[model samples]
Structure formats: structure tokens, C-alpha cells
Target: MALRTRAVLVHRRTELDELLDRHATRGQAEFFLRTRGRTLADVESRHEAAVSARRAVAASVPSDWALAEVERADLDRFLFAPEDVVLVVGQDGLVANAAKYLDRQLVVGVDPEPGTNLGVLVRHDADAVAGIIAALTNPPGRAGAAPSAVRCDELTMVRARLDDGQELRAVNELFLGHASHQSARYVLTVDGTAERQSSSGLIVSTGTGATGWSASIAHDRGGRRLPGPTEQALAWFVREAWPSPATGATLTEGMLGDDGELVVTVQSDRLVVFGDGMEGDRLEVSWGQEVRIGVAERRLRLV
Candidate 1:
């Protein structure tokens, strides 16, 4: 069967929209923010910009191609087609969120609020999306109006798989720890070495995540090194590992090559494994269960 190319637009609700939902009215939301020494004008302006950007993207979709829209909260429930071109119109974090549900589809990050956002993941301006779609639909050598070829950066991702047939993937990092952020007990095995340890949690980060949370840890450890965005290897860290009579912190950190794996056996009553900070949607590992994390088989094709 010939696969149809669909454009999936993923976004999140604006702060103004969220406030209105909580307060039930714009006036109430404004008053609430005013009490905190804030105003609604900035929020409203950003909201309008986001709406305009989305409208522009929607209007630029090719007439023959299928289009679908999904909010951040509904991403887990949304079904993505195999031949889809996913467009994330939000911050870098939103790109990480949508990357979990995708496979081989090409992803384009659209920054709705240009100057405010870092544009690390949402790298394209709102007006450039039409050209991107045109170039994608009409690759080089094809008879079309596309002026240039779009460059795709295949970014690596991390995967966590539990013994119970559950799995998750992320563009940033995978966090395995207690749900309450308390001390977690587990047996960690990496690079052929094994040890029982108790700590806050474990963070397995990819090159893409090196600039975020993992970077902080690296900075703390006398500027310990991490991988680059396209690097095949990944870095793992055991947060605040405490040595005790029954546990050791010797195996607190290391790197995993393309063929390497990190296994953790749950010693606590239960532990949670979430990717890209989405703790709500996670895998639960019970006593004695082993959770293996490694480089994911699929890489994110970001345009």
C-alpha cells in the first residue's frame, strides 16, 4: 500500500488559555496575575502570536496532503501515521514530548514566539514552514517549486525497557527513581560492573540532553564531559549516591557506547522510569525487576 504523507501539527495550550481554564474567565485570570505583580498583556500578546503562527502553518499546508492537529495533553492518545511529517509549534521541550510517539517521520520544529524561545529544538521561524513543506514534498531533482534541499539532523535518543515488556524512548534523558523524589534503592549494573546503591535516582542522557539537566551534573563534577547531539554514545549519572554498609557509590557514573546497556534491578518496593521528564506516563518497576536502558534503535530526523 502506498503511504500517504500527512502533516501532524503538535502544540500546547497558551498560558492565557490555561489561566482562563482555571479561573473560568479572562477577568478573574487577570486579577489573579495582578495580585502576583504580573500583568495579562504579555501573556495575551504571546498567545496571539502563537495562534497566528499556527494559523499560518495550517494555511500553508499543501491541498493534497492530509493535516492533523494535536495538543500536548492529547499526544499520548494521538495516532501518528508512518508517512507523517510532524510539526511541533512550541518550545524545545515540546519537540522532546512529540519525539516519544514518533518513529521514522521527519520532524520540523516551529517557533511561535521567535525572540523569547531559545529555538534549540523549535529552530524554524513561523514564516519558513511553507517553504519547508514545499521542499520536503518536492525533494531535489523533482519538478517542483522548491528552491533548495532541506537538511536533516539525525539526533540520537535513549530507550528504557523493563522486564515486563514495557518500554519508553526520549530525545533528552531517561530518569529512573522514586516517584516522590526520595532515596531510591536499586542494583545498578553498567559496563560489566554491578553494585547495590541507594540514591535519589538515575539519569541516562543522550547528546541532545547534554545541554540541559545532565549538563548541570557535568558542571558540578569539575566539568565532566558529555556526548554531542549526534554522538552514538550516551552518559549516565547516579544522583547523590550514598555509600553504606550494604551499598557502594563506586559505580555512580559512566558512559554507554552504541552497543552498551545499563541494567537496574529494583530493590525498593517500587520505582518509576520516565523519559524526557514526563513522569506521569512511566513504567513501574517492582522488587527484583530489571530495567535495561540503552541507545534507541530509532533516531530523531529533525529538519
Candidate 2:
């Protein structure tokens, strides 16, 4: 069969877009920014850059191939095929947000703003998109193919599964905590040993997510540095494990091997499980529900 090169463009709303949506007018949005000591011109320029980058990417897509545009918010509802080549044209977080919805599709992270934004994941510029796509779809050995040098790096992922058969995958980390500001109650189990605990929340993170919230938790608890982004193991921490007569704090920090798993039974009325900082998209576990977390079987292939 012929190659099916489908470019799935992923992006999120800019500050200007959000401002206009909230204030209902460009003038009102400008005034709102000015009141907060921010410049409307800066927001407008950023928005323009993003638009330019998106247009450039759209133009670069091969005319004979398929193309689809999707916003970050609709990722959960979008059905991604196995042959789709995803091109995320936004911040680094957009790449993380898109990873959970994908299986083994090749993803190209395009940095809309090159110099102004520090993009650890969105490393390529818009101008390079055409060449990347060409190389990926048509290898050098194939007929009517171009000389291309596209490559991909594999990144590990974290997977969480509930006893009821619900599942969630995250490129960064998984947060198991109370839905609100109240304390979370759960029984954490590692290596067959279990402990009833009450504290702030539970964070199970892969190596890719170690630089963010997981790093902060590791620093506060004097834990070791997490593995690399492509590593198979995961590190987990219990945030603010409060000691009580009914809840123990002995099992607070540890590493979960590839074959190993960490299990948690909900003692609270409701505990939320979300990945990659997208709290709106989450799995709710009621009291008596069990959740198992481990390194995911799939890995992200970044081209």
C-alpha cells in the first residue's frame, strides 16, 4: 500500500484569543491588558507569529496528502489513526498534551516562536516542517523519493488504570489527589506492602516529567534525580504525607520498575487522576476503587 502521510496540526489558544473571548472585543481586551501593566502590542505580535507559523506549516504539507487541524482542548475527543503524522505547532506543553491521545504515530514538534519561547519539546522551526515531512514519508531508498534526513527520538510514558477498566496515559506525570483543596485519603501499595495514608496527593512521574513538579517534590524530600526521558522506570512520591493514628507515612517515596506496579485504593469519597496537567480531562475514582500505575507499554516517537 502507498504511504498515508496525514498531518495533524495541533495548537492552543493564544493570550490574545483568550482575552478577546473573555472581554468580547479587541478594544476591551487591550484595555484589560493595559490595566494589568501588560502591553497589548506584545500579545498581538505573539498571536501574529503563531498565525504565521501555522500558515507556513499548512502550506508546507504535501498537496497529495491528508491534513487536519485540532485544538488542544479537543484532543480527548479526536480519534488519531495509527498512520497519522502529527505536527504540533505551539508551546512545548502542547506536545505533552497531544502525546496522551496518540499511540505510535510519528509526531513533529514545531516551535511557533523560536527565540522568545524556551521549548524543550517543540524544537523544530516552521520552515523545517516541509523537509521533515518529506523525509519521513518518502525514504531515500524508495522510488520517486527525495534525499531526506528526518529522525525521531523515543520518549517514555506513564499509564494509569482503574479497577473498573478505565485508563489514562500521560507523557509527563500523573496526579492522584483530591478533586478539591481538601486532603486526599488512600491506601498506597508498593511491592505488595500497603499503607493507609492521608496527605496532600500522590504524584507518579516518568523521566520526561522529572524536570517539572516531580523535580520540586524530589528536591523537597531530598530524593535522587529521576531517570532520563526515554527510561523505562518511573519515580513516585507522596506529597506531604501527614502522620496520624489511622494513616501512616512510612511509604512516601520510591521507584517503580518496568515489571513492577504501584497500587492505590481510594479511601476518600472521590479522588481525581489526571495526566500532563490537564485537570479538566480526568478519571474520577470513588471510595473503594483501586488504581494501578506503571510505565506505559508505548513510547512517544518525536521526529
Q: Which candidate leads the pack in lDDT?
A: 1
TM-score of each: 0.95, 0.94
lDDT of 1: 0.89
What are the lDDT scores of the predictions, listed in order? 0.89, 0.86
Show the lowest summed lDDT stretch of 10 residues, model 1: 139-148
| Clash pairs for candidate 2 | none
Candidate no. 1 TM-score: 0.95
Q: In candidate 1, which residue ranges exceed 4 Å CA deviation? A: 138-148
Compared with the true structure, what per-residue lDDT tens digits does model 2 show for residues 1-303? 655557789999888999988999999998888899998899999999999999999999888778999999899889987768889998778999999988878888998887655466787999988888767644433422323365677898999999999999998899998977469999998998999999889889988899998999898877677978888889999988989899999999888888989999999887899998989889999999999999998888887
Across 133-211, the per-residue lDDT of candidate 1 in tens digits comes to 8787533333222233888888999999889888899999999999997999999988788999999999999999999
* Leading candidate by TM-score: 1
